[model samples]
Target: MNLESPKITLEKSATEAFNFLSDVQNFKKLMPENISKFEVLGEDKFLFALKGMPEIILKKKEVTPYSKIVLGAAGGKLDFSLIGNISEIETNQSTVQLTFEGDFNPMMSMMIKGPIGKFIETLVTNMKTAI
Candidate 1:
């Protein structure tokens, strides 16, 4: 399954946003308000738990300066990739996008599509104010 966050314009420059996101720990600040626990395990990894979901550990997979940051589940029931794409719009302004892609069976996809979509939307919405 593939879930995408809406493209958002942010006040920070592309490089600034990239720098912030390159450090996976910063993602804890962008999670939903209902998240029960958040832990920064290391510079490249973090764990978080939502209201009804199991803990998920995210690790930085790759980062391309001022362009993209790719993250993946470190070890969990879910196998997924979260990608952040950044583009410069103007001086001190940037366009940002987030996408979540998971490997799920049909039944699981049906169960998670809506929630995942909403989660992505909430994440991006919060991210707009975060940066």
Candidate 2:
């Protein structure tokens, strides 16, 4: 598996941050135009159709106030599990740190290498604007 960590700083409170983060469906609006068919499931799960691929499921594994959240998604085509996590949330003078990490399968790693990276960047950018 390949792991990468990307962090984003947000100018928002913990609760406000959670509120914005918890709304899973907004991903369609936040992600790039290549993304489509976004569907939200319950509090922390979502399924979306990424261009050129079948639908993928993202399930929230955990969540903690002013702390962290972990989401995982994987399929047989992948050599390993793919897990994305947001952790080490801490408030600065007027900003909060939203740290993102991804663990990907060796075979499919390169396929998502750039898009996933961009996805995280957009995730933070949207979070900043949402909150």
Residue by residue across 28-70, what tens digits does model 1's lDDT show? 7788888999999998999988999888888999888999999
- Tell me, by TM-score, which candidate is best: 1
Question: Number of clashes in model 1?
Answer: 0
Task: Assess the local accuracy of residue 122 in candidate 1 as a C-alpha lDDT between 0 and 100.
Answer: 84
Per-residue lDDT of candidate 2, residues 1-131 (tens digit): 34443555555556665545556665556565677678887667787776886787776666666455556663434332233334434553133333335455656677767766666666666655666
Task: Give all candidate RMSDs, comma-separated.
Answer: 1.0, 3.8
**lDDT to native, each model:** 0.88, 0.57
Error of 2 at 6 (Å): 4.3
TM value for model 2: 0.69
TM-score of each candidate?
0.95, 0.69
Clashing pairs in 1: none
